[model samples]
Target: MRFLSSLLLAALIVEQVLGEYGMAHFSDWGNSKGKDYCIFFNSQWARLPQDLSKATRLQTYDLTSSVLCSPSDVPEGGFPNSIPMVMRGNCTFYEKVRLAQINGAKGLLIVSKDRLTPPSGNKSQYEEIGIPVALLSYKDMLDISKTFGEKRQVAMYAPNEPVVDYNMVLIFLMAVGTVALGGYWAGSRDIKKRYMKHKRDDGAEKQDEETVDVTPIMICVFVVMCCSMLVLLYFFYDQLVYMTIATFCLASAVSLYSCLWPFVRRIPFGKCRIPENNLPYCHKRPQVRMLILSAFCIGVSVTWGVFRNEDQWAWILQDALGIAFCLYMLKTIRLPTFKACTLLLVVLFVYDVFFVFITPLLTKSGESIMVEVAAGPSDSSTHEKLPMVLKVPRLNSSPLVLCDRPFSLLGFGDILVPGLLVAYCHRFDILMQTSQIYFLACTIGYGIGLLITFVALTLMQMGQPALLYLVPCTLLTSLAVALWRKELPLFWTGSGFVPPPIIMEQINCTQTPGPSTDEPPSNPEPATSETNNQREDPTPATQEEVPHLTDASNT
Candidate 1:
């Protein structure tokens, strides 16, 4: 599972980097006869294009001649170029679009000099152009122009919209494959271990067994925590934001201590040992450094999260911090058993589905519970509002400085719920003396599940309960693998199970011993010669019998 976790971490980092730039593609396209046509175009901005329904399938006009050349060089009655320094006969894309808008053309298609080269233009510069414009490959332009010469109207339309990227699909597949492999490897290893243990205790069935029964306690804790979070998110959002910052700080401090403690322990005189108890205490304590650094980071994150209104970098920093905290939890927390992890997932699955899907139906306003809460102001006074959510912003630099609304949002529940299962799987692997396959499997399942949830949200354009997909993928995949390996029986029985009758038989066998000449017997036995003589003479006990009879007569 470590491999899966590492892959997911890598994928996430890639996603973060790519998400910053946003993805672009044509949202809708059609031709002049009202039949939809596919045209390949690159996105210049992350924002959605303005309404283009009326402009669709409009006649295409080529103003490349006048718009491409220098403004001073263009002859009267030719296309007017807006940019002055553009080389003669070389198109300044922005100028061409401006000229097209000025000429009242419904659509403009520019032919690229090279068929393989994508058209480049500043999105902000062309925002006010109003008309639909597209840059076509030289070959496509030629084909269209040929059709136009035949008196058939040629039309082109291009509109950029915010949509999910293809990379997400790749991420999903990678996640699934990684998780399945991990589960299979882990399940195989666990089965081998159990088989070996069974062989070792072949005749001895009364082995001491320890069962872990923390399921109820875990469920209760989960329920309480979830309820508290929901309450805070819905009613006391501002306070929740503050709490989130403080929690991040505390988590950071602990993480710092953990990282530095090992090195601190290695230094001479760094740790002090008591003479009486021989208990070692750290002299070069990390607490002070942890406190100072944590405080500094907390102050910066909070100040940025609260005071820096609409600051993209501030939000990005918060997202980074949140991710770091989640990763730490994933690394530290341990789940007692695979069964417990499955139970937790199943419960959260129902919980997630209800809050995301059913709550909207129940509400009078007909809004998703998560969405409403996420978008709602943290405070009654909007001016003092703080965002409780962790968001990563999409930034655009070309043509203008614009920050697209945060494209990625991560909820605390999303991290903590699956994290518990992953942590549990990690501990299970360690307990079984196996590799980290189980943890990798669980982590991969989580990544794949999250990807599915994101895909659903993108396709449906609505909020989705993540655990609806996550729980089944993570729990069922690993469970099925275990079952296939025939490990389920032993695992379900809490590591090792022995029937009571078999246990009792083994106990009796161990307690009772076979005949041994070297040890004294409970009853005395005569020597071999005496035993033979008694067998030969049927009245061997005559002397003892006469004595007994004489004694009785005397009495």
Candidate 2:
């Protein structure tokens, strides 16, 4: 199920990249207003034209440069030309566009250098070009050339209406639902198998000792990290995003190695001992291939994050990779119990609500804390940049690609908080020797919660604390299911809330002893029956008994 989810996530990433980079079609040409084809051109910093559709009728004209610079070119009219012009040349984009603008052209179209690749040039050079401009692929340029050669009149009109792609939305929803169902089923099956095995082994094996208490240390570390991250997010968002991309790339590469460690160990490496117990442990000198792959991923991430302008494919890849790493960590780290999960969710729920909603009210600006930070380098005057959030591009049928618009976003907290509960439920299922239905329920509930969040966001057209919906859905649904199965009492007393070993020992010491085979000696002994019973039953003791046990063993 995890594998399936990973694959689906990859597909979604690819779709986002393609949708953002892919070209919109010139569906038809007519005098009447209908669809105005959207085009992205000019400098990286340039904004889309707002009034392209306002023009009633547009005439097309083939363009040529008067100056010769490259082979297979002809010199033609230069300045004082009228009408929109299409030019095919190897000259720099700024030079050609400048010349066309001076010649009184209403619009400009540059023929691409190759059939598949779009024309490459510095879009930011000629910001003052007061005309609509577009780059045509080689094939498109040729088709337009043929149309002009046949003396056919070319006409263009602005789009009258925009449409929504319901099909795409439905597909995305279906994919998410499938992942939820599949994960639930798989977890349930595995839990049942484990439960049967545990039942067979129950009487023969001793229960494990209670785990150590690391709560204090964990809390301290979490608080420190959170404080540091918040500081960075507020002040150095862009730099932080770049660093995060690089870090996630490196981390994901390492995680990928860990996931494939089993297969990796099987590969023959002469005279080197593979550590079976400590998998994914690097040798004194790691394999060249591993180092190279890691370097490559890091390089790509850094390069993309730093250099790509207005090209959101890089953001999609980085965000998806980060998500994959987080999902992997969630699967790997087992949470201790249901109580722990509940406590975590409760704390995070409040944390999320405060950061998202209350922070604005507290601050003088009355702006959402997260939204202010997520506004990248372009939006902020500080010139800082960061990709701290994951965004999924929303697809619509409108010819105008709203790439610049805000996308569907999930904060890091939204994922990590609920994921901890899901992981805990998995561990709890194993500890109780029960079907994994609890984990499955929590996962599905999380998905449902996210769906609700999306619906609310759509209706309200505002930012929401995802945990507001997620926490209740996951906690209540899982709790209700546990209650229905008569597991609530067990959860409270047993695996869900096991007392410390010291307390357990103390309780045992105070209780009356049961019947034992060893009889009291026919001599003066300890006055208490508790001592006699303890001697007879010979049950294992807590850490407090370690010193006495050592002395007895030495003697």
Candidate 3:
């Protein structure tokens, strides 16, 4: 066990070191190096003729102007005498797009050094870019530049392409695969089974001796729910159409009725036990305390939501207290249960802090202040255009400058609250707490919170616009509450109140002794009058002696 723990520690250290290095070299999503600007074209000109109809005739001066001109000798304007353009060699298209935006460039053109393989279809086309973008061959560039001397202006067209980082996408895929493989390996190991065995009661039966008929029933339930959601969409088309459809798909794909899932285990297949007596067998102080701390973090997040920037100092104070608590916990983790808690703490701290700080430094430089001023009024008000706070890098250009970015406690609070809640639910099976009335109430609250956080965080990660993201989160939370109301009674009556029965039959049947060899003694006769007076009973007759058998062992 010690050796295994040491191995795991070593692996974690290695992983962390690699992760840090990866972050330093790549963007937040593990894309190519995120340098400031691409400045391939001037902001004054209409962006790279996305559509021929929208194209404005480029003026002689605007034809070769640049917003963020680097002192590079790269040819520009597709003309031999064209102006010098600053071209960023980011390894991913997404970074190129972002860099173009930061530099206030009118257009971006990405060229590959290797042979270009155009995407087969434009199903996932980019709807819009802050600036237009195009892909061209090196030879095409040369030919176009040679004509530039004659025409002095060339009509180049760019398509509406969704600029996604294929490399980042590949990394995401690999990480997911690695996690799945690790999970499978861990599941196949003996440790979990041994842990479950040790945790079982001394005498209990197997969990699933009888065949269950849950499949068809579950399928029917799913069908009914999906149909109901469809009806909701039909009736409340304007209000609920999108939400209803999303819910239906989620239920269909994620529910147990689905044919098979690679990552998710079958809900009813595992033999989790409900203790007959309220012994709190698996409950440990660290586990319970972790739950409490997670809940507190959520509460803080909620409080932050209610009072966005008003309680900044209070939030800071609370964080300090939390740090102190962590110090206390460091000492308390001498026991095994707290060891897992320690790991959880370390992970949460590192992941949150890393992203919070790194995002700013990795981002490209913003457009010039005068340029933003020169642009005409946008549909949004000035305040709307400005991020709640203006984040600027410190004069000291260390990685620590990321921390100097203007802080938004609310944003951090929202992310942390949900993530920690999810971890809490997973660690303790809080969803299974509906058995007792007190626990049921706790579950209802926690479940609602969990649903909200799940939807909110998922939407945040999915690139939804900031203003609209909260709606989905709120709606999901309300839906969860309604579902809990409907299921509470059933939960209380059936399996909810009864702890899952622990299986202990395996323990009793684990090992056997060698066959016995001692012979049976002669059986004594029934008690006589003297024996009765002596108050003693005769020896019970052996099974072989009593039964009409050739040879048999005694009972």
lDDT of 3 by residue, 1-555 (tens): 222222112111111100000001111222222221111222222234454345432211122223233323223433222221223243344454444544444444444333222211121224334444444334444444453442233233333322332322432233223222222222222123323433322343232111111223333443344334323422343454233223322222222111122222223343344334545433322233323334454454444333433433544433332222222212111111212222333343343343333433443422211112112111112211111111111233233222212221122122222222222222222223432332223234433443443344333332111212222332343235426656433222221212332422232222222236265323323323434433343233122122211111221
Local distance difference test values of all predictions, in order: 0.45, 0.48, 0.28
Span of ten consecutive residues with least summed lDDT in model 1: 13-22
For each candidate, what TM-score against the reference? Answer: 0.48, 0.52, 0.26
Runs in model 2 with CA error above 4 Å?
1-228, 266-312, 377-385, 489-555
> What total of clashing residue pairs does each candidate reach?
5, 11, 7
Relative to the unseen true structure, what is the Cα RMSD of model 2? 12.5
Give the alpha carbon lDDT tens digit for every residue of 194-285 in model 2. 33443322222222211222143454455445545654565576556555545545555544444344344355553233343433534334
Better-scoring candidate (lDDT), 1 or 2: 2
Candidate with best lDDT: 2
Worst 10 residues of 2 by lDDT: 11-20
Misplaced by over 4 Å in model 1 are 1-159, 165-214, 238-240, 256-310, 377-390, 395-404, 433-435, 493-555
Instruction: Tell me the tens digit of each residue's lDDT in model 1 across 1-555.
Output: 232222222112111111112111222123233222333333441122333443323223344454444446434554332211111125555675565456444444555443222234554664565544444444444544454442233333333335654434543443343334333333333333334443322222222222122455757565555645654555665555455444454554443344344344345552322233333332323333334444555565556545546564666555445444444444433344666676766776776667666776776545544554554431233323223334544333221112123345545456556665655454455544447665676677788778778877667645566667778877876676557657675444334222245644564344434466467545434444455565477464343322210021221
TM-score of 1: 0.48
| TM-score winner | 2
